[model samples]
Target chain A: MKSLLQNLARWLVPVCFIAFSFSEEPYQLKLAMSWGSDFPVFSESPKRMAERVAKMSNGRLTIDVIGSEEHGRPLDVFDMVRNGEYDLGHSASYYWKGKVPNTLFFTTMPFGMLPLEQYAWLEHGGGQALMDEVYQPLGLLSLPGGNSGSQMGGWFQKRIKNTESLNGLKMRVPGFAGEVLSELGVVPTNIPATDLYEAMSRNVIQAAEFVGPSTDFNLKLHLAAQFYYTGWHEPGAELQFLINDEVYQSLPADLQAILKAAMRASAYDTYVHSVDVSAQAWADMRRQFPTIRVKDFPDEVMSELRRVNERKLVEFADDNDQARRIIESQLGYQAMMRNWTLLSDYSYLESIGR
Target chain B: MKSLLQNLARWLVPVCFIAFSFSEEPYQLKLAMSWGSDFPVFSESPKRMAERVAKMSNGRLTIDVIGSEEHGRPLDVFDMVRNGEYDLGHSASYYWKGKVPNTLFFTTMPFGMLPLEQYAWLEHGGGQALMDEVYQPLGLLSLPGGNSGSQMGGWFQKRIKNTESLNGLKMRVPGFAGEVLSELGVVPTNIPATDLYEAMSRNVIQAAEFVGPSTDFNLKLHLAAQFYYTGWHEPGAELQFLINDEVYQSLPADLQAILKAAMRASAYDTYVHSVDVSAQAWADMRRQFPTIRVKDFPDEVMSELRRVNERKLVEFADDNDQARRIIESQLGYQAMMRNWTLLSDYSYLESIGR
Candidate 1:
């Protein structure tokens, strides 16, 4: 009878191995996104990622995406994901600069690399390793979520002609860019997106900086401001996906690959979608509001802003070694990439006469 | 006794179903590529796609990639895939122009939209549907494989200051751009990659148009040529992945999704890789050879080339209804996208004086 039981155990071991190899256990992960439920392209990114994950994983891995409206913690995505309250979160890295100073350089900067250039830096120029170094200590893994392309600097009630025009000017520009503006005597303010239109219409703010045409058109800021300045700050703002290291590690190898591939494809799709929507929206806005005038900030003002920007960057890099390394990496890569950009796309556009 | 037999059969059916559900068969696919095995980013794209598919599918699907060097057929990828001789092919749409004239517009056109703009048109504009219309009739499915970004025009032995300089110019340029140049009395030739350096050095060809810095620097063209021209043709050349439709449909749903996600991610990565490599190669070349001069064709030459290109496009459109529709779609979208490009990235770059 004992010999019979041992033989049965030997037979069952191979059976269990075969079943385990073929029948993967299903995993369900929850994702939090930093947008409202109804947000157009922004909301669509994580949803697309989830759908791809489900399809590619053969229903073995499913991701449930919830917007900030449902989660009620738009600004706390980093904290939530790091603490393992959620498996993942989609938000811009710069939003967490207050908590992790090194996070600021991962998004975009004043007069920074464009979308492709920034992507090149992240994927090939040690930017990803630096990013991991900063996030790993906090128990988080981050991937690029999407890009907003080059942003529009702001909408202004009056054109900025000189450095003096910025003096005592009130505007709603947030983050590092706002700090740079304040150096030029602009009174930078931050307001909720919901209040932007009302603030501009009621003269609560003299100028407002928001995203480009796609999202900005939703707020109807064009009706309130006549002069639209092209982007100087946030040249190519990239959003990020934050995952808890433990949750990521707990997945099977195949599921991990599926999650990463889905996230990457969705991020790229979002950028392409932004480009499409922004083009259509800009064309529509200009057609309806024929009086809208696009202006570039004057050379004098731009030079002063660049000067102040350099000063602030140096000051920020003084204390923290990680911050200093990140800034230097970006600056050095930007210089090399900008040279190529000037030779290729920049030259092509110029020769064609925009 | 018959009733007992029937009961036994019914019991065995459920057990068979459970085992079948837990054990999936592995699938293998064969892919043919246009480039040689040593080709840098171009060859890497399909290889990367195969790797991701294997990982994401947990070894359920494996792809074997064959390059032109091994297959001895560089331009027959479309036909091979369609005929089921190969399950997939990595090539460019423009290569099929001889067989299907409409395939020409899917790849980059002379003086067409840049990379992101073209991607937007393909994804959000009607480009993909149109591409499907062209390829579906041939029993193939196509996806964007990768982009070379904006290519440098070509290496020139002499600076071309006017259209007259192009008369009897023995240059090796290919495809529709070559056709356009032929109108200006330039003799456009096609030479094998192995002979490009020798041809240019021996005065067998006064100029040659190849891919940009990353690939071009490999041929040592700068050693023989003094002037490098920025691209007027192939602004954003996108390679394609062609799959046999029936073979694609044969895959289980999850494997199908994995294949597509892998391709998409690999394609985007290839583009990012190109941007990085090109930037690094260009910087290195300049540092090593400071004498290489980069030039843009003068306005006289550019306007004339544009005029000829338009004429050819019109002539080509007249013959085929599908061709006309595709060209019109591109033109319409380009008109709208160019406006946004001018307002956003173009404006920002000009403001910075790169």
Candidate 2:
């Protein structure tokens, strides 16, 4: 009788295990991204996230990443995910500025905090909660996907002798930055992404603002102009991941944890990967293009630009209550954190004198 | 007959599921850390890693983190993990430098690469493989556990007048930094961690090197002396996680994936968390301790320190063949990445000039 009862208990345990673990069908999520296929370090975030999630879930959950080229709607990721056409998205938060003005603050700002400092604000200084507040109402969730370090000033057709050289320069700068440049007697124009090379080569635009060396070299923007300027516009541009709220709620707690942890790790890895890629590309650029001049805007020009930036920030505060709140929070946090930044990495670099 | 066959198939499916999932006993690994219990951000990595792993693995694989207080062995983490007394450890690589001289290069060095630069080297510049080469022989695996940004020059009892102020200064600094200081007419010595406050307050040491404000403030080391100098030694110090090779190999592939992913996320999180904590702590310290004065070592002293640091690095290379390889790789990589750093973050800071 004891042997028979033990046998019955063993069979019951297996039955319970199967029903609990394998009863749910394997989950396959469709992810929409802003960039086209194989977009170098930028697209690697979703790819790695998918790979990690599949492994962590023991193949129980998988992600199918579709780039903008395949999806035929690069800029519609926000709409697609919100409408449930895609389970998630990988894109920059600033892309939705027309519809959601607060989204612009989450990415980089002109003369704003660097990546580490910005991350500190986001993670601990209420930036994340503000980000959550903006996205939660739209049935979407946003998290930091990656950072591409600091963007360079631009590839200028001619060497800048002083701050006044930018006064009459025709440049291909867009949106908020364009407005800032316009205040300094410069003519800023928005050119389509595909026309950037042609515009710069033909002197239609005398200078172009792209990314740092990695993506810039890929675009051969430096080939059009050899003078690369150090950046102040977009200090540290951060990419973001967008998840649909309903889809997120549907996952079991374990799977949800796996998804978040994988995304966090992938996000961090992407930043480090960008650092490596940009460093190598910058070195290669210098070696290949011996004429490449890396110049910083003169202190007077920098000081003037910051003054304009501060004025623009005051106008930006009038957008709405939420915008006012985020801008104030970021400014306050940056002021507090900048003291330490000056004392730490900035001071360390100065002391090393490297 | 068909209904009976269907019933049999259901039973067999469960049997297979039981064998594949939840078939083994729950994996509970003992992780020994080098810090005492509840050691703030330093201990948060393993604690969070264990929490994340438990959730990701659905409680099948749980880690029991025992700090040095409970384990009764703070300095023996590497040995404890290797001897199978603990499956893993959280500590600095330099802690093992006395036993394995090559271990000195893994943590931050005097005038070495900063955190991001070193991470770029480790991830893409063959640093991971080189680190593995050093550790694989000891039946241990090491990975970056966290970074505390940068170490500050010790708090001094008296204000520095100039570059020559450090001459004949008695300070409580240990290991490689102590060796470098000894060359510059400063007396360097190591005191136990607990007695640092007493020694500094009693004038046993004129200055003391703890960590940045987060841990340093917690230690109340700043209270004894208020003239804080900027750091040159141990810039961007990174802590490490050590895993026993045999124990690591015993886990299933999915569990291994979960363990690694958790540690990576935890490590990155710890660094960001430190930035936030230190930033906040520095802000609070300035407000609460208005008497505190932050000073930078004069340019002449900084230049001389770098010259001596370069020489010491040459001597460090002669420690072993592997040490030579790591030192060369670090120096070469730092040279390459520092250009980008100067152009990007450094230039950005200068332009903003906040």
Candidate 3:
């Protein structure tokens, strides 16, 4: 009787397993991204989130990632990922302005919040959930994937004599910064990577900003634009992973965690690598482009730019409800940061004379 | 003549370095937080970041983080960090609803974006810059330093029956999700950690959502509430490292990058550890709380809750211009993600099922 009961219980366990697996239409999701085939983000953080979910359910739940731009161009990533054409896509949010203008705020801004400030606003300031409210109706899930530390201002061709020189100067600027520049009389232009070199060489654009020296040199823009500037307008630029909603819903809980963990790791790597390599890249660019004139924007020009920025912000706030909230939150944090900076950054620098 | 020039250049380099170091003013920064001195989030990331920055710059920069309710309650972290009363602080964003209503989007949301999503929105989606617009005037800077992935729903004394049960229910929730819950009629409360146990035990609050299994189990919530729920409303909850703008600006460029990089590493660790330990904690919880009932919220509840969420969204969007832009950008990304998830998550799962 004991043996029979034991045997029966074992068989019953499998039976129950099968029943549970079919409990609600077996939501098995496969999230494919190019970097890792289907689940590149899994490599960074929420490590093993996907795998854990799969194993817990005894193969009843599974999520796979396809990394690399195997599906399409990096630019096409946001659309492909969001439309459910692919399960997910890993690309920078700044790269998708054609789809969403404000999406670039998540990645970067010209002379805006650093990574930490961005984190505070997103988490405590109702930024993250607001984004979800924005995404869920479209059947998508968004996640922060990676970050690039303060970026080097883009390589430049000629010295910026004054704020006036920036006027009507066609440059490959994107997103809200572009809007701000346009307000400052800059002819902001958007060009894909393939066309950047030709544009600069032909003087179709006077200067351009592309990530840092590592990425900028990769495009060989240093050869065309001999003047390189610092102060990344898009400081704290971040990358993202876009996953389909239904597909994410299908994932087992554990797998979801793994995907998150992996992506976090990847993001760390991206930021670390960017920071470590950019400095070296800048050093190399100096050697490679000996004629490159490195100069900082004049204080007066910067002051004017700041003024224009304030006006544009107010205008944007007036035009867009969401922009108003963001500006309020951003300005709130900046006020605090400025007070802190004045005491710490300013005082320390004064003492050290750097 | 060559030797004299070389000697002059060497002396000039040292003098210039010294002058550069001392040229800037020092700003006072007071970082306040609720965690104990031993807490990793409060202690580790900032220490490493500051140490790394100082070392990289050969002691040209300095950062200090003080912990343990130094400012007041954990709920006050955002204000302290944002107001420049604290040069820096470690806290979750959801705690600051009184000031920045939309800030939670960067942290975690119910069935919303995960850590990766938070990063995505913050880094690429204009989330970072937008938040800066929120914080710049506040004199604050924020970076995501840690994350808790797919947290346990909460510890409850009674099982959640229908969506109606949420009405008038006192629950501890932070961020925009808290607002969503409020829309669903839940009384959202923000409580510091020290008070959670007493509040739950005394029936001051019937339900509470903490981080994950590890943190919850450690806090011994099972002793108070026997019913454990799955399906984390806030998956991949993020923790932020904040710095006063004054403090951040005071640092040298290289030091700033170093600090950013180190924080990135800490943020990565936070997620990895949470995901890894949660699994083990679940097993332990099962062993310890044999009578604990684990249940999932009814589908009807989720659907109804979502409907309420939509109403709140429209209302907020109509009122705030920034919210509107973010909604548009987020909606666009969501649409794209939906298509991607279908192909990657759904299609792959279906194939495996076959």
Candidate 4:
């Protein structure tokens, strides 16, 4: 009986305990990033997530982040990941608006909830489910990757006084904000990021929108524009982690949890980190380029832009049920959350009389 | 040869690979929460942490959360956890202010940074290291647990127009805010939470400050006082996760990572969740109790309160190097980050003209 037990144990070690070998060796995953390796917050967030996953999994899981420079195509990340060319991809959701119209709402809108408010909607107010509905159908799983706190309205050579100020102005603006600007007679032109500085410097384009101060600082945008306006678009631009569903399902349950938790933590950390970086960049801009003036759109200009944005949103959602649903969810959640914001943060901030 | 190899493998499996036993079997830790089991975001956060920890560890690590009801003494958590009586503890940092004065800085403060700004400080602006200086000495590890969004100033029967309105007023406000108010001739009283609603309704105390709308909804403070004032004190109250350092060191590298990541994700989720719940509570309060008026203190009263809060901060920081260091860090970070807030969030909100 002892001999038989010993023989059985030897066989069981190879067959029933294959999981030991799997756990002992690390599982390597490919993460395709839309941002270059040198990009500050955009690139750094994924590296942090990868590092956290490796540490937490005790080397059981490893994620290699391949940047846009290495991938050779930033815009193709979504399609490549969807086609299983990569196990994962990091990019903004709105980048896929042409491919999927409803995708725009997930990133941010002309005017929408702030990052925390949007997160509340995602976690507690059906935003995640709506997101899943959009992504799961395409064999992809989308998770919040990071936030840009708030995107600056853009850099402009001249202050925007009203709708007339936008008229006949050429700008390197894109997407939904571009569409809204076009309504006010701003000529939204597409300029490669590399030429954005030249375009603005040489009067090829008089206005532009990059990201927030941290990212815009990298573009040397301060050298190009004098007026830096506050944001009306992309109030809290959230990035996404795009995973191939089949590849995601192939992971062991423990690894899935590690991946999920790592992404979530890294996403929130990224937002706070973005805020810190923005603070530094803003301070730098003030100290180095005191010539730069920070401006807000006049109430009349803002109200007109808001009116046009509302009209565009209606048209944008008119055709698709999913689009309409997402729009309604965002609208309702923002309305309700804005009240709390007014009462808590806005009230507290104004009370200080700062 | 095969039979000899089988025999060798059987012998080696038990001796050469004892790790399987440790990995296959679970390591369970005890988590003692300062809040009751039924507590909203406070208790739910730890439970979420445990669940995520369990899932990520695949049962290799388990955390059993014990609420205050089970622990019997809520305020004793910091001492008990420090004494190694519990493996972990979840409570507000300020609870230990009497024992460790510097700890009061960790939770929240009057005229301090908001939740997100404070998070930025903790993550990027050397706040965590300063926190480590305070905690590492106690043989404990304190981490960012969750944020209470913004704590409301409190409930009042009437508007606070000026310093005269504060004179001789009996209120159940506690901690640093209470100290500042007392300096302004207001009488601060200690009342048990269970008796708070009765105290306010029966005119035992004219006013009281609970948590924000979410947690305060449970206390039904609106039923006691007609005027619901916005927050000034405890701008963003952060809760803490207390871990026995030695117990933490005993965990495997993977489990440690899992633990840290789980806590972080849960902390952020709690803040967002708190926001959602607060929105619901505020909406409910508006619809059900239309008589409850929301007000901010007059600018004169606010400036006076701010002056006293700043004065008390200087006094609070005196004599303690760590306390002074923490205060200087907060004040400086707040001053810098407040610019970003005004340019981004505050500016955008104002542009909406809502």
lDDT, model 4, position A165: 91
Model 4 pairs whose backbones collide: none
The Cα RMSD in angstroms, rounded to one decimal, for candidate 1 relative to the true structure is 5.3
Tens digit per residue, CA lDDT, model 1, A100-202: 8889888898888888889899999989999999999999999989988889989999888899999998999998889999999999999988799999999
Tens-digit lDDT track of model 4 for A16-96 = 344444334468889999889988888988999999999988777899999988989899999999998899999999999
Question: Residue B197: error of model 2 in Å?
Answer: 3.3
Best by TM-score: 4
**Candidate 4 per-residue C-alpha lDDT over B1-354 given as tens digits, one digit per residue, 9 for 90 to 100:** 655655555555553344444334578899899889998878999999999999998888899999888989899999999998999999989989899878888988888899999999998899999989999999999998998898888999877888899999999988888888998888999898778899988898898988877867778888888988888888888999999999999988888989999999999998898888889999988888999888888888888888998888778789677888899998999999999998998888988774
How does each model score on TM-score?
0.94, 0.94, 0.47, 0.95
Candidate 2 positional error at A57, Å: 0.8
**DockQ score of the complex predicted as candidate 4:** 0.52
Which residue pairs in candidate 1 have backbone atoms (N, alpha carbon, C) closer than 3 angstroms, thus clashing? B153-B231
State the displacement of the C-alpha of residue B204, model 1, in Å, after optimal TM-score superposition.
1.9
Residues B1-354, model 3: lDDT tens digits:
655655555545544433433443343345565575567333555565555444433444456667664544666776666666666777766556467766645565554554544565566556678767766777877788677656666778888888888889898876566777787788989897668888999999989887656677778888889887664366566777777787788765544554555566567665544543454466577676789776666667777766776676677689788767766655554443333222222222222221
Instruction: Give candidate 3's error at residue B215 in angstroms.
Output: 1.7
Which TM-score value belongs to model 3?
0.47
Tell how far residue B211 is off in model 4, in angstroms.
0.9
How close to the true structure is residue B254 of candidate 3, measured as C-alpha lDDT?
Answer: 43
Better of 3 and 4 by TM-score: 4
Query: Residue A88 error for model 4, in Å?
Result: 0.4
Q: Please identify model 3 stretches exceeding 4 Å from their true place.
A: A1-354, B1-30, B40-43, B73-83, B164-179, B182-192, B195-205, B338-354
DockQ of every model listed? Answer: 0.40, 0.54, 0.02, 0.52
Of candidates 3 and 1, the better by lDDT: 1
- Candidate 2: where is the Cα deviation over 4 Å? A1-22, A160-164, B1-22, B160-164
